[model samples]
Target chain A: EAGVAQSPRYKIIEKRQSVAFWCNPISGHATLYWYQQILGQGPKLLIQFQNNGVVDDSQLPKDRFSAERLKGVDSTLKIQPAKLEDSAVYLCASSLGSPLYGYTFGSGTRLTVV
Target chain B: GQQVMQIPQYQHVQEGEDFTTYCNSSTTLSNIQWYKQRPGGHPVFLIQLVKSGEVKKQKRLTFQFGEAKKNSSLHITATQTTDVGTYFCAGLKTGANNLFFGTGTRLTVIP
Candidate 1:
C-alpha cells in the first residue's frame, strides 16, 4: 500500500500572506488528521476528519488556519495571513478509524514565513 | 484540554547501552500510541497499547502502558545508532477521535 502523500514539500511565504498545503491520505482510510510540528517539538493536532465530516478542530486557529477533507479522500490545510510563528512542518496522517491500527503519516510540508 | 508530556526532552547514550523514555498524560487515556521520527523525516507508527499494564515488544523495543492508563513508557535494549530519532507518545482519551501527542524525546546514540 502507498503511504500518505503531500505536495509542495516546501513553501515560503511572507507574513500576512496566504498559503495552502495539500495531502492525499492512504487509500481506504476513513480518518484523516492534520498536525503542526514545530522544530524540536511533537506534532500538534490541528484538525481531524472522519470521511469528509469534521470530527475535531478544537485546536485549529479558525481565524488563520482552516482544513477540509473533501470527498473523504484528500485534504487541504490553508493558513491565511501566515505569521512567523506559523513557520513549521504541516503533517497529514490517516488511519482506519480504530486506534489500534495506528496511523500512516505523510512527508509533510515545511513552511517558512518571512 | 488534555496534555501529554515526555521526560528528558533529549537523551544521549552510547551504542550497546539501554535507553528509556517516559510519557505522562494529564488525564486517563483510552489508549496510547508511540511513533518514531528520524531526523528530517515524518513520524512512523510504532505500537499501541490499550489495556492497563499492557506490554508489547518489537525486536529490541518494548512499550508499556501504565496501570493507571495515564502514563506509558518505551524502552530500547542494546541501543544502536539506527535508533536515533524523536520518540513521541500520543494519548487518545475516551470519546475523542484524535490523539494528543507528547513533547517527544529525542534520542542520540553515539557509536
Candidate 2:
C-alpha cells in the first residue's frame, strides 16, 4: 500500500507570513494526525482527525493555526502570521483506527521562517 | 497532561555492541508504540506494545512494556550501521486521545 504523502517537502517564509501544508493519508486509514517537531524535540500533536471529524485539537494554536480534513481523506494544516519559532517540521500521520496500531508518517514539510 | 521521558539523549556504540533505551511516562499509558527516524527522514513505525509486562521481538530488536504500563524499553542486539537513528517511544495515556512521544534517543554505530 502507498504510504502517507505530504506536499512541499520544504518551505520558506518571513515572519508574519502565512504557510499551508497538505497531506494525503494512507488508503483505508480512518485516522489522520498533524504534528509539529521542533529541532531536538519529539513530534508534538497539533490535531487529530477520525474520518472527517476532529478528534482532538487542544494543542493547536487556534489564534493562528487551523486544519481541516475534508471528505474523511485529504487534510490541510495552515499557519498564518508565522513566527520565527514556528519554523519546524510539520508531520502528517495516519493509522487504521486503533491506538494500539502504529501510524505511518509522511516525509514531512520542513518550514523555515526568516 | 501526559508526557513520556527518554534517557541517554544520544548513544555511540561500536559495531556489534548491544544498546538499549528506556521510556518512562508521568501517567499510566494505555499503549506504547515505537518508531525509528533516520537523520534526514521522517519517523517510521517499528512496533506497538499494549499488554502489561509484554515483551515482543523483531529480529535483533526487543521491545518491553512495563507491568505498570508506565515504562518501556527498546533493546538492540548486535548493533549495526543500519541501526543508527533516533528511537522514540510514543505512549497513549489513559483518558487521552493523542499519543505523546518521548524526547528520543539518538543512536550511532561506529565500525
Candidate 3:
C-alpha cells in the first residue's frame, strides 16, 4: 500500500510570512489529523478531521493556524504570520477509523521561520 | 485535556543490551498505541494494547498495558542499531476520538 503523501518536503520563511502545507492520506482512510512536532518532542495534535467535517481542533491556534480537509480526501494546513516558535515539523496522519486503528504519518513538512 | 508522559526522556544503551521506556497518562485510557519515529523520519505505528494488563510481543519488542489502564511500557530485548529512534505512546480516552501522545523517549544504541 502507498504511504501517506506530503508535499514541499521543506519550507523556510521569515516571521510574519505565511505558509501552507499539503497532505494526501492513504487511500480509503476517512480520518485525518494535523500535528506539530518540535525537535526532541512528541507530535502534538493541532486538528483532526473525520471525513470532511472537523472532529477536533481544540489545540489549534485558530488565530494563526487553520486547516481544512476538503472532499474528505486531501488536507491543507496554513499558517499566517508565522512565528519563530512555529518553526517545527508539521505532520499529517490518517487512520481507517478512529486512532484505535493506529495512525500512519507522512514524511511531514519541515518549516523554518527566520 | 488529558496528557501522557514518558519517562527517561533519552536512553543510551550498548548493542545487545536491553532497553525500556515508560508511558503514563493523567487519566484512565480506553486504549494505548505505540509508535517508532526514526531519526529524520515520521512516526510509524508499532502496536496497540486495549485490555488492561495486556501484553503483546513483536520480535524482540514487548509492549505492556498497565492494570490500571493509565500506564504502559515498551521493552526492547537485545537492542540493535536498527532500534535507534524515538518511541511514543498515544492514549485514547473513553468516549473520545482523539489520541493524546506522550512526550516520547529517544533511544541511542551504541555499537
Name the candidate that leads on TM-score.
3
DockQ of each: 0.83, 0.86, 0.93
Docking class of 2: high
iRMSD per prediction, in order: 1.0, 0.9, 0.6
lDDT per residue (tens digit) for residues A32-72 in model 1: 99999999999998998999999989889999999888799
Report how far residue B21 has shifted in candidate 2, in Å: 0.2
Off by over 4 Å in 3: none
Clashing pairs in 2: none
User: Chain B alone: TM-score in each candidate?
Assistant: 0.99, 0.98, 0.99
Task: Tell me, by DockQ, which candidate is best.
Answer: 3
lDDT of each model, Cα atoms only? 0.94, 0.95, 0.96
lDDT of 3 by residue, A20-52 (tens): 999999999999999999998899999999999
Number of clashes recorded per candidate: 0, 0, 0
- The C-alpha stretches of model 2 lying farther than 4 A from their native spots are none
The per-residue C-alpha lDDT of model 1 at residue A53 equals 96
**Chain A TM-score values for every predicted structure, listed in order:** 0.98, 0.98, 0.99
Q: For residue A81, give model 2's deviation from the true position in Å.
A: 0.8
lDDT of 2 by residue, A13-37 (tens): 9999999999999999999999999
Each candidate's fnat: 0.84, 0.86, 0.97
lDDT of 1 by residue, B1-111 (tens): 799999989999999999999999999999999999999999999999999999999999999999999999999999999999999999999987788899999999999
